[model samples]
Target: MNFFKTTYTSKLVFTALVIFSSSCSDDYLEEMTYGEISPSEMTSPGNVDRAIIAAYSLLNGQYDASSSAFNSPASNWSFGDVVSDDAYKGGGGTGDQNNIHLMEIFNTNPTIIDIERKWVALYEGVKRTNEAMRLLQNSQEYDVALKENRMGELYFLRGHYYFELKKIYNTIPYIDETAATVNDYAVSHTQYTSEQLWDKIEENFSNAYERLPNDQEEVGRPNKMTAKAYLAKTYIFQGQWQNALDAANEVINSNKYSLLPNFRDVFLPENDNSSEIIFAVQHSVLDGAPDNYNGSIGDRLSAPGGPFYSQYGFHRPSQNLVNAYKTNAIGMPVLDNKNLAEADFVDPRLDHTVGRPGIPYLDLGVLYEASWARDLSTYGPFAPKKRIVSANSPYQIKTWPYISALNYYIIRYADLLLWKAEALVELGDLEGARAVVNQVRGRAKDSQYVMNLEGTTPAASYRIETYNTPWTDQATAREAVRTERRLELALEGHRFFDLVRWGVAAETINAYLEVEKTRRTHLTNANFIEGTHNYFPVPQKYLDYLASTK
Candidate 1:
């Protein structure tokens, strides 16, 4: 069965099981309910399978356990994109989801709802993964080989959850299946240093890489290469260039993944699990859920307001990002804060990535107008186009919130290539890094350009070229790789984290605000402080919860 495509029946069953199991106490009389199953009785292979599916379910970041859907979206649109120079919190007004607006301006506090809810959602993922592992470990009848593979999946998943927590919060408490009691789960965030935490997270991926098979029968399950890619990404974040390069090369030489022929096809629902995708949070609609929570529910607010889309327009593209796509006469990127006018030659990916005014938005018959944006005067006239599903696609759910079944990619092949490129740049392999960057840019250069209505003309002055000359300078090569990342993976929610990891979040964002404040009045007070804004504050409630345990 397609584990991710299943209904929410397993989730409900698993939740009830967790509640029932946790409620048992020694103070109660020893009595057995006739119709109910005890925790021990529930430790079967089938239930373990259901629990694992429940763990997989949380990858979409739509847990009903705690948190509003948008507060902890799987896409990290607010935390990763809006908080950076990439996007703005676009909606009816500043008052609408003002918490995100606070985040956009880098004024976040420990008690912000988004911060707390996201922590809860990610921890919930860890809890579910550990619960599955706990069940599997206690089982007596599961096949040995299958059990090993399933454990590998759990390790990979737990690593992913912790990885998200680490990147967002920096130093978080690490818990595992060994933490059986309530007290065990109440460990402090300060128990491990930041570097140690990365090591802990890396250990999970290493275990996964060791145990997982090279290929899986299921569509969404990660294989050995997936774990290796994550391991490489982990090393990149830690500045372990040699280790990162080694792991990245392992995945690269595997010949298992490749970029899609057309860049635009990568995000389409039909290509959700294509070879380009290393791992994605699988989503489906019309799966017997009345609310359609199984779809891209967290990103529902991002639908560009128009005739066919939901009116709650959020995650609008920034003018800074739009300008970053501009190219010079030879199709090279115009770097170092150069603003490009509307008529400037731009990379073709911009049309596919951002819904600019007068551009055709996907399969919609009409050209994307300025009015397609909600609160255009405040957020800007641009809307996000990459994550959105076409109106005519079967994946689109025509309802109050236009949630789609498009998968949110956790790691795409292009992202891995960029990671390897970053490592090579750091290791002083400038020529090698240049070649890897070209592999990504080359795809854009050769891919089909975005076409206009009636397929009669080019959407804009599309121009993109790969690096042809040898990179003699390391700094230039590094900057070139970083810029290419923005162009290739702009609105997919990696921009802020990337800047932070590169130690340029403060300088980059403050500079962005200086220029952006002039264009958009909302950013007049926005400032990014280096020491304070490097990572989000650990949620105060969690700290309070830990103190109460003490």
Candidate 2:
């Protein structure tokens, strides 16, 4: 949510600035920083742009935690396999946030700090945008058409921030205008019923869609399609299926963006900023403008262990998730009761989704033996891709050396396609859904992941089998899509909330725990009561600050 903001006071300063500063869209964060005016000399535009960057910089999301060079959610954490009692670090921060932690429905670990930071960061982002909105609403700068064109991006940012907000924290305190100081920071939060909040969120995104351009020469900023894409997501979650379909179709029809031929380019640094990226956190390591590859998710997932290296493999593949990958003797996917001998390196998706057992991890052969099983010996059936590196970098100066530095991809066309397919399923359009689903499946074989490297057994041509999602009925389709999402978006910090929104916590999870008995070793089943488990207690610290009366 707050992609990358830091410190409360910093948040307060930047956030205050965001709400009051006046900035144009592209220049929103790029105000004249060098050799600028004094306090009395500085005007609105100058204040707004810097403030906008401050919001993006601190939104708990500057970089992808999963895909980063070194994972930072504490090595002993149950980072990826969250939502199961199977993973916990015996410490308390905000897990009590609403039984969201106790139930394993939410990753109570502060890595979910993105949730908090994004809330503040987006509000800050909104502050900057609202300032611009307020300015352009009556400014003498540009003509009305030019003003609205600029306002399009500002509105998109505000709406996008709110949409981002409601997804995590349910009913949030709504702020329609800018906030500049302590007095502006209301002691009490404004309340909106969930429906009403979504209404405001929808209105902003709708205005954004109408105002934002269909295409931008640059890659990151919001476009008409960008606004629509998120609105479609918001609408689907709100259960406004028809509107969801229409919003998605608006982007699909725009012809400004298209799926890249190879799914891999979507993650490449060079390939980003393309027409396909409707919206992205425009990260630039160039000229040190603060495009942080430093704390990203991709780097963590791919990094071998070192000083800056955070060993988060402490989160393992649940036997349930592993078995879910298992296919019968027939070459297809299935969910059922099975024995280990029958599972002879079968379901290739298990490798695709996780670096466990049969997947390739650069220098490491296969994953499980290399990392989890504690078998340093040239291991058994599968060698775990030990991301924890014992290899010493000769000229090491920085934190971790053997770490891979791929940036985190928050929204990609692949996910959008899946979202579209999932929404179509809910709206009773299976055939339409299948079209998008198969496109992904067809390309799964080409995944960079090499499947059957352990060459003792029989090998036909089942090498790059990605997580499969066979089409089914609405209920089953939703399950398939969710499963696919967990697999596809695994470790990129997604599944916990999916379980909540789908309302599948008690059933899908306990059922898994019943079979995967190992998880019980880390969890307390009673902690996860049903109803309250879906939310985090609105940070108690936040409430304590409010006045007694109003």
For residue 9, model 1's alpha carbon misses the true position, in angstroms, by: 4.5
Question: What's the residue-level lDDT of 337 in candidate 2?
Answer: 34
Relative to the true structure, how large is the alpha-carbon lDDT of every model? Answer: 0.86, 0.48
For each candidate in turn, the TM-score is: 0.95, 0.72
Winning model by lDDT: 1
lDDT of 1 by residue, 33-59 (tens): 224446886688877787788788788
C-alpha RMSD of candidate 1? 3.9
Q: What would you estimate as the lDDT of candidate 1?
A: 0.86
Candidate 2 per-residue lDDT, tens place, 3-52, comes to 22121112213223432123222322222233343444233454443434
- Backbone clash pairs in model 2 (N, Cα, C under 3 Å; residues 3+ apart or in different chains), count: 56
